[model samples]
Target: MRFTSGTSFDGVREQLFTLGEIPGVLWTPEGAVGTRPLIVMGHGGGRHKKDPDILSRAAHFVTGGGFAVVAVDVPGHGDRPKDVELDRIATENQARVAAGAELAPLIAGFQALVAGRTVPEWRAALDAVQRNGDVGAGPVGYWGVSLGCGLGVPFVAAEPRVRAAVLGLGGALASAADAARITVPVEFLVQWDDERVPREESLALYDAFGSAEKTLHANPGPHGELPAFERDSALRFFSRHLN
Candidate 1:
């Protein structure tokens, strides 16, 4: 990993970094000593590692909760060069949605194409960050919504290091088999009136999780209208499991 830039605010130190071709950011609590619990965050589709929502959540984890945070730009999002096929699919999917066409099959195909690449990239980011030796060793957790959750299900399922997760705002884009493989504690958020993801599919995705300790938080809102209280609840969940 190569360090690019850094800043500090309200006792949190945010650093920009690049691991090979992947561009990412790491946030550590100021004056924090030794290895602390680490939270690997994932951003929504069309958003990058530095999206305002992602930054806010990372700040909550590091500045308010004293956990280290890291987030990478997913392939074809953020700083990564666009994949022609993936871009084409995304464009077509948007057109279909605008035309009031069904989106599940198209979304499923896109997820299948991208999930394979994303899962390994997340693993690699974890490996590179651990090698840097500052984020602490207490435990690892994940927090991601929307596209983040779509890719995160399989990543967390495959990764043994993550002990807990915050996932939601995504439906059954990937296979239920992948969600069924995640055995760690999970807190899933569902927007009751989400326009993009159907309520039934979101509930079904939550039900597919293999974790014995899982909670579903459904609020009445649109896809981007997740309540602030839900984020507070998620912080508490991670604290209980990771701290």
Candidate 2:
């Protein structure tokens, strides 16, 4: 857990750090300390920990909800060395989808390969972050969608420290069993007209969760067009469960 740089702006402090090979970023209210809620985020496919959306949401969780938020680039993303095989397979999958091949099987196999490698990395990141006093022993939440959701299903289910989650923009083909193991509060999102994830599959993923307290929010949009307000809803969801 080596922080390479630190910066502060708008009452939120940002730190860029590396854990072994993983590149990650942490955000918290300025001068924060003691036990505070932590939100661990996973970026979507091709996105890094500090993309615009992720940075904005992390800032909100820090300044608006007064929570600590962190995100790490997972396998082949951000500053980590890319996997040639993963890239090849991803390109193949995209071409197959365009050729009218069924998306579920292709995506399922790809996500399985990625998730197997990522779950352990995420567990390590969570362990390191929580040990830092600013986030110590506090309730932890997870926010991830798309590739993040595929990988998160297993990580969150296996990690009891994650008390709540905001997951969506992915399907059940590869993660239904893990989803059933997640008993924490979850707020699952769905795009009514998602082109990448089939609607039935997304609904099925939400149904797979074992959490007694879970809510499903479906909006009309494509996979990349989630309404701006859903971001607010995610913050509120974390607030309700973590604080």
Candidate 3:
């Protein structure tokens, strides 16, 4: 896999040392620009930044809406080269890995490890954005989905520069205390019948948010069925907070 940015956007560059030692795509709109809003986007479990489904919608956020977007490929997924895939660990007896039993700890560790890499990388990206001068110079925000949401929580929690966040189809951290640490306003977008992740977990997260400015949107549908709605809601929510 290779890290890539949209060639159509001007002032675009690829940052190699991003979260999880992955690559991030940075895109700035054409011609006139100065100190615009920045959004650090994250992909779902096994997708890349240029996922046809995601980038198609994301193009609106960058080119049409004029937001600088940086979407990173998570370690062991997307364009990042990986030695092993967790889901590939299947034996005769362990055909299906136990739900939370096998994945919870692994996901927790991945998020922690990824969070450790975010600050330095984000600072580097911020520095570059500032240097561009014509590009992003204002506050930053985050938008994430599925496993991305899991990582985004810790990312925003540690980096207060993120003014707001939009999380789609993902749960909060293991502890509400951890969730309470985030200071920015956040929007939790979830499907009521998400079978992959319990609906209760998302609510527990929404209920746990310590930020007084946060809100929760419970949309109708299942996990995969709601990505369109999630995208619209996230765009609107981020616009409200970022602007």
Candidate 4:
């Protein structure tokens, strides 16, 4: 990983970096002593690593929970070169959804294609960040919703370093079998009235997790309307596991 530039604010050190082709940001608490926990923050589909919500979550984890946070632009999103075929597929899927056509198949296909690229990119980011000795080696965790959850399931399952995870707001786009391999503590969130993900699929995804310590947090709201309190809850969850 290469550190390109950096700035600090509110006791948090924010740095822009590049891990090979993937561009990303790293956030660490300024006054944190010794080695601190690491949290990999994932953004929703169509969002970048520096998205406002993602940045806020990173800041919360670093400043509030004393963890180092990192986020990378998923393949074809953010600063990465856009894939023309994927863009066409996404547009087609949206049109199909508007016409009340079956969306699950299209969504799953898109996720599969993207996940193939993203899962490894996430690993690369983790490897690159860990190479920075200053970041320290501590318990690692993941925080992601929607597309983040879909890609993260496979990534976290394959990466044994991640001790806990917060994954949800996504459905059965990827293989539940992949989720079954994740045995770490997981806190899964679900939006009761999500317009995109079917409620049954969300619950089924949660049930498919192999983690013995998994908890489900469901609330009434649309896909993007997750309660802000859940952020605090995730922070607490990470604290309990990583600290």
Poorest stretch of ten by lDDT in candidate 4: 128-137
By lDDT rank, best first, the candidates go: 2, 1, 4, 3
Q: Report the C-alpha lDDT of model 2 over 173-236, residue by residue, as the tens digit.
A: 9899999999999999899999989998999999999999999999998996778898899999
Please provide TM-scores, in order, for all candidate models, with all chains considered together. 0.95, 0.96, 0.79, 0.95
User: Scored by CA lDDT, what does every candidate get?
Assistant: 0.88, 0.91, 0.66, 0.88
Model 4 Cα lDDT, one tens digit per residue, 94-125: 99989988776677678878888888888888
Runs of candidate 1 exceeding 4 Å displacement:
95-100
Residue 44's C-alpha lDDT in candidate 4? 92
Q: Which residue pairs in candidate 4 collide?
A: none
Off by over 4 Å in 3: 1-6, 9-21, 83-110, 118-123, 173-175, 227-229
lDDT of 2 at 118: 87
Residue-by-residue lDDT tens digits, candidate 1, 5-24:
99998888889999899999
Which one wins by TM-score: 2 or 4?
A: 2
lDDT of 3 by residue, 29-89 (tens): 6554578888877777668876765565566666555677776666566766763534344
Candidate 1 scores a C-alpha RMSD against the true structure in Å of 1.4
